[model samples]
Target: MTAGNNGTNPPEGDDPFGYLYRSENGAPSAQGQQANSPRRSYNEVRAVGDRRYGQQQRPQPDQSPSPYYAAPETQPGGGQGGSGGPGRRAAGRANQEPARRNGLLIGALAVVGAVILGVGAAFAFSDSDDDKAGADPGASESADAGQDDAPDPDDGPPEEDEERPLPQENGSSLRLENGPVVAGDVEGSRAKDGSYIHGFKEGSAALWQPEIEEDGEYTVFVGYTVPGKDMSLQVSANDASPYSARFSNYAGAEEGDWAKGWTQTFAWVELKKGTNDIRIACGDKAEQCSVAMDRIWLEKGHVKK
Candidate 1:
């Protein structure tokens, strides 16, 4: 205080500015202290710079953007960053969750539908096989039923209004002819020339065998021609007792024109299973006995046992 402090001075108490000084001499003033102070290190200066500029020292190129500083805002649930708006993250999750769920549901439905279709196809194939397996038996049963219901084929010949004669050949023996034979041993018999006869026989007879297992009705037809003679013919089987009838009355041939054709109708006869002989005899010993017999034929009828 005497002549005005010149170079340095000391504070009165422990001064707040003491941290900036060294105790090398009396307390230096502001300008003198600055000249004597040590220089700051590069690291220290860089740290201070970083703090002031809000930057890091040598930040890596690959470093992620800071959540608080990069872009507009960050998602609340830690997804892609977006505008700093309310419910941004929630809205993102809401949009994506339904798609994921829908995908999952679709996948599940596809699997379920595939299983259902597979099961249905298996069932259909099984049903088809079952139907195929059963069809054979059904068809066989139907065939058997049809066979049982069908009519027997052993029925007799059909009926006709007019009786027809069977044609005879040279091989047929035991033929009956009218009197006055054309060129046989009996040509000059008691009958007139070319007249009819009564008891006529042939040189050969036809053989017949019956089916005994299936007994049935049979009809025998005998064809004859007569001339002006009302005659009756009798037929006997195996030389048994004869059954006689006047064919003139039955065939409506009684008009006395005997040269016309005549037919003898007989009842249905049952045949046995052996050889049989059929014999014909004339009924009347009348005038000019002359007749011609053609042939005999057998026919089977219904009513089989």
Candidate 2:
């Protein structure tokens, strides 16, 4: 029978493992020195892991190039013109892929940021346009500011009414009840004839029948004078309850000096929308009645105009 050799042939030497016991065969020991001969070394220097079974032996750095292997300058992917090797080219490609992806990501982010900024600017511009369009351009801010600066109704007097003359009657036109007329005597009398009624010690009174425009509250002003003393006068409108009007010594004059003591006082009264009867008198409930009366007037509101 023939033995199977496959593609390899067996060794035909007397002993293939003889190198393991070469010292017993009179071979030269590495440490022993021979007569007149140089010493031999058994240790050889080569690159670590350069030789392996069924693998090509890598050349040492100090050795010249072998005829079986090509030089680094002539091999593919070895020189500067080509990538260093398959492993190095793959590593370089992997590294370049990350850089490229990062660059693309940065560009995408920049685009998104620009889009967002543009959208925000557009919204801002649109809002500004809408505000301008909705607002009244021709209107003045003074109107709104005036509203804020306006006086509160309860805080102060109301705005002055129009120039329409209020319904009023002077002393000369009014009818006298028990008081006597003093004409052209006292100074600062607003009556056309400068006539005034006075001397209402107990039942003295001045009466008026003035026509009113509407039924509302009215302030009846009496132009009078006191000689350095205060007094309280009685006034009534439309025969309603009487009101006590204060008469102050506004002129600061001496006693019996009715010429220099000229001032006015008022009282609140209600009247109907027609002819209304008004009266001022010094009756039983009167305080000091020694006063010089001059003119009479009416305002529409409870405030003094």
Candidate 3:
């Protein structure tokens, strides 16, 4: 009914928690208890965390004041005249240690990241340099130094691949056999003497001995004239198996006009680097033998050139 107990005992169960309210009946407050009061005996008016609970009370050593709940200005020598007590200093140091560790960790991570970036930048620069070198014309030339030189645009296109220079032979150099004759009657001969081998037919042959520079495949070209019809002859080299060498009617000349019927045809052959003998004969297998031979030559590959 009142704010305080007026220094008197309260009624039983009147308010066991009455001390929590304003005490208008004048009972001393929980904070106003003196050193010898009954409230001080039970330590009820002490700070919340001042004593340990659920433990036996024993003689305790004197220790520094707690930093918790203590004001910086109220601790011994903590005012403007002093920095702080040892307790405040210790708590300040403890609080700052985690921040210092975090700062150090962040700085280390930044340094590591910078190193990684530097390495990556170095690799990128190296790759860029390689690419630039690859695109450089001088570098390309050096890389291809062991290969064949490229054709110069001003010098004209590169010549086709040939192992050796072609060799030419005149019809007069051939040894006529079996009704063949070397005469000047046909006027379209490319020989120096304007002569050609003629009258070659079935069972006839013209053999020539020519020199070769290399051992490989070659093309044998025959310059001849046909009277308006396709003709062929049997050819053999080194006494090997004979094969047919066809000569087409490329001149379009009428019958009996050998001057207008001069043309060339070719066949592939194999020869070694030395003297080789070639024979053109109208053998039994020949499709036609009515062709006048004027020249025979060799090219350096399997295809006509």
lDDT, model 2, position 20 = 37
Question: How far in Å is the alpha carbon of 54 misplaced in model 2?
Answer: 99
- Candidate 3 per-residue lDDT, tens place, 81-198, comes to 2346676677778899999999999999999999999999999998898898985758967868846566667998776686555678898888988888888887888888898887
What lDDT would each prediction earn against the true structure?
0.48, 0.72, 0.75
Q: What TM-score would you give candidate 3 relative to the actual structure?
A: 0.45
Residues 86-108, model 2: lDDT tens digits: 66677788889999999999999
TM value for model 2? 0.44
| Candidate rank order under TM-score | 3, 2, 1
Q: What are the C-alpha RMSDs, in order, of all predicted structures?
A: 12.5, 16.6, 19.6
lDDT tens digits, residue span 168-211, model 1: 22212344434323332323222223332234333222232323
Global local distance difference test of model 3: 0.75
Of the two candidates 1 and 2, the one with more favorable lDDT, higher being better, is 2
lDDT of 1: 0.48
Counted clashes in each candidate structure: 17, 0, 6
